[model samples]
Target: MDKSVDLQHYYLELSPEPVRFDAVSQLTNVFFDDAKQQVFAVRSGGATGIVVKSATDGQNISFCMEDRGTIRSIKFSADNQVLAVQRNDTSVEFVPFNANNQPNVPEMLTHQGKNIIYGFVWVQERQVALISKAGVEIFQLNFEKRTLKSVKSLNITVNWFSFCPTSNFALLSSNMGTILTPVILKASTITKLPRLELGTSQGCSGRDVTLAQLYGTNAIMILRQLQNRQFEVVIYLLNGPGLAPKKSHILRLGQSGRFAMNIVDDVVVVHHQASATSMLFDIALGGAETEVGSGAVIHQPIIPAKTIKPYTLEVPSMSLDGKTINCDLYSQHWVLFQPNIVIDAKLGCLWHVLLKLNSLCALITDRFRLVEFLLQRTEGKPVLLNVLKEMMSVNYSGTMLPVIESIFNKLNCLYKSVLDNELQSQMALMALSTKSQSSKLSPVPRVIVDQSDAYTGVFSSITDTEQLGKILLLYLHSLARNGITANPELSKQIVIDLVRNKQFDTLHQLLKYSALNESKPLACFLLSLSNSDPSISQMALDMLARLNANEIILEVLLEKGQVVEALRIAKQMPGADSLPARKYLEAAYKTKDPLVFHSVYNFFQAKNVRLRGSPDFLKHEQCTEYVQYYQTLISTQCL
Candidate 1:
């Protein structure tokens, strides 16, 4: 039986209908702000302008930017408060924004001769960077005065400034993509004054190539399509702290077809047109030497032996021998299949490759097959858990819950299969023993029994509750280890099972190893179940104390009026001593509790006397306040 659950809940269709201005109109650029739920697009040909629309409903908003010249690019400010529009006539315009999708100010324009603005971007809140044939110029926009002032300019003939999506760094590729300079705006001044020759794409010319880089790092990746349609993703690590590119990699993706690349941190994802499959690459500094499987190195840069370690995840994949592919950190034992690569969980990498894979575009069948292959592997649990962790880490728009549940179901089925096989073996052994013993006895009628009957008898005879508890505990631990906290239903169900079977010890053990944040739901559910049982309550409290859950511990202790216990827990916590003193003082004041007053006063008096002349005495501000207050209390009582 196909045990796959209905995945319709995770299905989401983002059908963005294309808008046709005329037969010759073409989409120039597109941008999406998930925060604002808006989509911005630039088109040219029959109509040259920008269009803003709702990302969800695809409804066009009132704001529009239309002109006769070619709309080169449409960029949103870093703050998304304004839109910067550039034209081929070297004229730049800023349209101030309003809350109601209305144009709030008159269009502010700026020009730098007739060189034609190659590209312009809103680098900062009030600053814009414009690239023209002459050089790169930075301007500050004054929304109040409706004008732009030139703040800074780099006088190098600029090709394009490839801005990092997440940071202020832009790869300034000028002199026709030969010289690459990484420039970042720092408090209105550009930092990192060095530039290097990266050279142009070997077989591609003029805007056919794509460049990608990240903020806070100097690694620049260039993706180019060859004349034969073969695509290459080249990583260039430069001009950063002990950072250097390992080698360029030729990808199997987009073989004789086009491909698109996206870089997030050290990982790069490529969506290929030929196979329609997504390939993930972990870009790092120094890695183990491996054969450049399918990729040939264009240039090899010698790097130091011991440098900043590269964050790499080992996948079951191979590279061509004696090539640029470095196998520095990944283990050699994990085997890579022709189309599938097995990833080992023990590989000391950031597991970000899994994260990148989640966002990469691929066919649904490919994703399903990938998950199935991992689940069937020997080290499937950890690898699948890592996948789950990546899914939990990001707010992905794709279907993930079904995949997670499918993993869970497969694990359960495996456990069940093992149990069934064991039961069947035990039944067969028992039946043979019975036949041998009954041979000497009277021959009973050979009554036929159904297979179901024998299986039921075997199951009923099983009494290994401990083994069952261990299995359940393993399943629960697997879920908790993977940070599956969003599924409160599953968590609650498991807690109920544990509590019903009086398995407090196993529950405690499971909670002990789990992360504080990830174990919250199970811990909370355990507490709720402990209301009627003293032993269960104590176990839960002990687990919470070991978890260092200061907030809940303090709340429980105070509610129980266990002042000494609460004091101990509080003292064990950082900067919590003052809490118990304040609480006891408040109790003394509110209820005229003489016992509480004396206890708090006496403790403070001893602490004050012990540290009276020491330098550390003044540091205990809470102790000082309590000492004075207690002294006043005693004096007033004496009067």
Candidate 2:
């Protein structure tokens, strides 16, 4: 059975190019207006105005907002030609932009102290819906005339309002504090709906409460902290047809005693201030319920039936220095912000992270910065080469390969220099020894001649086998671990050199550490070479025995015509006795080669004699047939 699994799950996919925007000081909100090909960012406090830039490359453009006050909230029109800005001083204004994305003078649409703007949403082109502490209001924008007209108004305090990302339904919360009724926006009609409260109003007191409509669905997530310091997130299918409650989850906070949350692709991720670990929970719309006893409908929440395993990522200085990590869902990418690094969940795919890292490496114009970031991120693990392999294998620009080749070439040159130095020193010592020994050289009697075991023949140039084995082991291990492939022909030449130079022990040691599939050819080569040396032969057989290669060993014995030894070995192994027995039967009956018929007949006759009057006496009955066959061969003068 093949036990290898696919390696795609081990690495992440990354894009070769990444878009980075310049830092905005005191930035509060960012939104993209795709129709205008521009991105708008709003800042608060000092020198406040909307900054517009090309969305593709984040280059500053000629467009800017006219509102000079502290902008409370900013929303773009559906046509991307109009802008609405709410200020902290209870004022609301609409600014219209032209084809060149240049904004004109703003027109104030404030309620004149009768209402305070809470939030707003764009339902249709040339129309805007506003939520305020007083009620809901709909306004129409006359594009050619550049004037605003009030279309509809409601008398209710809406704390927050947002439209569903997919469905046309809009969710409106009447209040941020205390238990209150929320409403739904169906076309232009407003209808009151029950709020998806996570806990009772008493347990929610003295705790922070938040509500957000999830992306791509009509579901709403209610996040609240209990008075006892436990945080819970409950998801409710509040609007649309056949919507219902889905699931609930709890959170634990540590360290600085605070946490942040973000939802992406139907999953909620929470990161705490005191630790680097984050938790992820899956929230799906529909699932089957488990069987239970029928009783009154008590409105208790059904705990979520499925759970998503939490994905843990390393954050630098988060736990030691109490630095918090920021998580946000930007353009469907879950980005985790640390002090010196940004980890996007798109990194879970191997290619995506490598390309993004390469882009970041190029952007910073420092390869060492990316290397440092990777080392710090992995906490000095051996994944540096792993990251490098991913970066190299997917690179098609023909840039990084030369850099890698040059690096390894320099390493090879250094290693060769060291080996040459060591060889020169050893040769110098050998010369000195010969010179010293020449001074006392004398011819003695033939019976008293002396000899040393020093190597002085063809094998004299070979290095120490043990030390050579160590170096080869290290080299092979490093390449294998990084998933880099050396030239196959070069590898074969190296092995051939080892065998030719009489480094059998080193070759044997290397074969032991190699993977089974990679070692097969080398094993066959070793078996062939083992015949020249008894020590090498024993080593080869020992390796085969450890690997449970019985068939090969039996083949070896049979090829040398050692039938008795083969039979003895096969007999000790259960279910292997039939092989040798069948071989002898074929030689006597089928082939009719009778030069050694007596030998085969004698073996089974001995078995019959040994098992006489026993339960297995019939097992040797084939001996009688062999005896008769050999007798007939002798009568025919064929033996």
Candidate 3:
């Protein structure tokens, strides 16, 4: 057999049968063992298992073992040599893996019960920080000496606990307060710091408290409360020092049927229902609130389920560098969920078959997985250049440009392969996609603006009237084409400048060429201009009313001393009955024909309105006389 076929056969031999834990079972927890290059998942039942696949060879070694009670939590040791299993029965067990270059049976390490394990972290090879419902415990294991010891225990019952990266201290959150304590591994001593009281707010329930990473070195604790029978978000700081109590910054999520929170550094990413929206907040060390992005939903769901349930969905996991978020979505195939994935800010690399597959395209949604895939493919500038060219040709903007630029910059800085041609192409595409011109006719000369320059006092005092005219025209064209609503004063100023520069011809061309119909607000402004003239006004009014603009033409004629001609034209216009009553009556009076007067009177009466005016004036007399004549005309016509 071929070497590849032999490897496949070996893998097939090691592959376990697909075991469905339960029909209603969901994978409640997943831990990626980076050291061993394996993924362990615990389902709702006490089912525990590990899928050990070589990151290089793509070979599978599956292990499934039954544990006592439902598995509440699961984790792998830092070295990936041991797996920790926490059960709902308040028991904790450590399953040790032998690295003896042969198949071996795993041995259980610790079996202690206090309360359900809420959180746990392996501090080193021998020490582990474990949090339970009752409090926090430190356990030490000396494999070299074959000994395990229960170290120190804390007083307060911790709902959750996390260790700081640099110190032996662990952050603990409980119903009473949040505490940071130093871990004295040898002596089993814990020196507790001042407690940061979360206070007695109904929203600060122990179960609803969740943590999310922010942009800085801070983390946010999202406390959900039942107010008026609806869940509301009360955000608090987690990484900062203890301070006096203050009102929590409440976010009115407005009865989100379901929601999920994820922390990436100091940015808290929240996805909620009520409005299918995602929000990012900058968590500060002092507990200050700063919302980053709030609008539409940008990220796509990994598993697009119909109903919103209290289930955890793993998005792309971020790396230590805080740049890329790795994502894996299993569509119809299980192979897609294979591990050995790294999604950096600029690149995503998936190790398959000893080769790295880089993804150079991003999906419309800000899915970490897709982003990582694209980044990996385009981490080299050449790939990014090709993508930029394609995107620019199609006029795709927003997420496309940012993703491309980010990858381009990263590749340019990291890889020497990024050539000038690729960089130039990316820059050109960004300019094309994001550029807003001030003129189309008198197109302004391009002047590169440094992105790093602040836009404070950066007003251009252009001495060239030609350039000014070009800029104004570009601005107007952009407004019309993009449907951009400028401030009233700014719009008026632009129009004044255009008029002063005699750029009406350019303006007229822009109005005619706009993708938006001439009836739109921007188009209306151009039509209202005095220089727009009779022809433009007539066109605009016709488009706005979806009619012949006969009334507008008549008004123009009246202004030019051609009342008789206007009246003649008005009478011939289509849908005469649908014309404004005032215009019909005025045209009838202008015609000075009794029959015309009678028609106007009959039309107004049919519309259920009495002619209002003196019967002496020609206009008034015409209306009054027509009403009487209209009745007789109607009776005669019926007979």
The best candidate in terms of lDDT: 1
Question: Which digits, one per residue and each the tens of the lDDT, describe model 1 over residues 1-639?
Answer: 221221211111111222221112234544443223344555545544555654335456545444546555565665556776665556766777777756554555555457767666566778877767776678888867756788887776666666553445556666666776667653356554467565554422333333444323445556666567665665555545334343344333335555445443333455444453445454332224433552433422211111111232223446753233333323432211111112222231111122312222122234434444444333344444444334433343235545545544544444444445566666667788464532222222112111222123321222224443333344454444443332445445545655676666655665565422335445556667776466666666777766678778666656656555666666677765345455554544444555565665565445546656432234434446555655677788842
Candidate closest to the true structure, highest TM-score: 1
Candidate 1: TM-score?
0.42
Off by over 4 Å in 2: 1-19, 26-39, 42-49, 53-61, 65-67, 106-113, 143-147, 159-171, 174-176, 180-192, 197-217, 226-228, 239-256, 284-639
Tell me the TM-score of each prediction against the true structure.
Answer: 0.42, 0.39, 0.38
- Provide the clashing-pair count of each candidate structure: 9, 11, 28
Better of 2 and 3 by TM-score: 2
Q: Model 1 — which ten-residue stretch has the worst lDDT?
A: 300-309
How many backbone clashes are present in model 3? 28
Better of 1 and 2 by lDDT: 1
lDDT of 2 by residue, 92-206 (tens): 6777777887776644344334666666767667677667777777777775665667777677666655444244444555435334344555335555555543344522321
Per-candidate Cα lDDT values, in order, are: 0.48, 0.46, 0.43
Q: Which stretches of candidate 1 lie over 4 Å from their true place?
A: 1-51, 54-61, 64-68, 76-83, 95-107, 143-147, 193-196, 199-219, 224-230, 237-254, 263-267, 281-639
Summarize candidate 3's per-residue lDDT along 501-584 as a digit string, tens digits. Answer: 565554455345442233345435545665635555544544444434556556665554455455557658776434455555
Q: Which stretches of candidate 3 lie over 4 Å from their true place?
A: 1-49, 52-61, 64-70, 88-90, 100-107, 111-119, 159-193, 225-232, 238-255, 264-267, 274-276, 280-639
lDDT of 2 at 630: 69
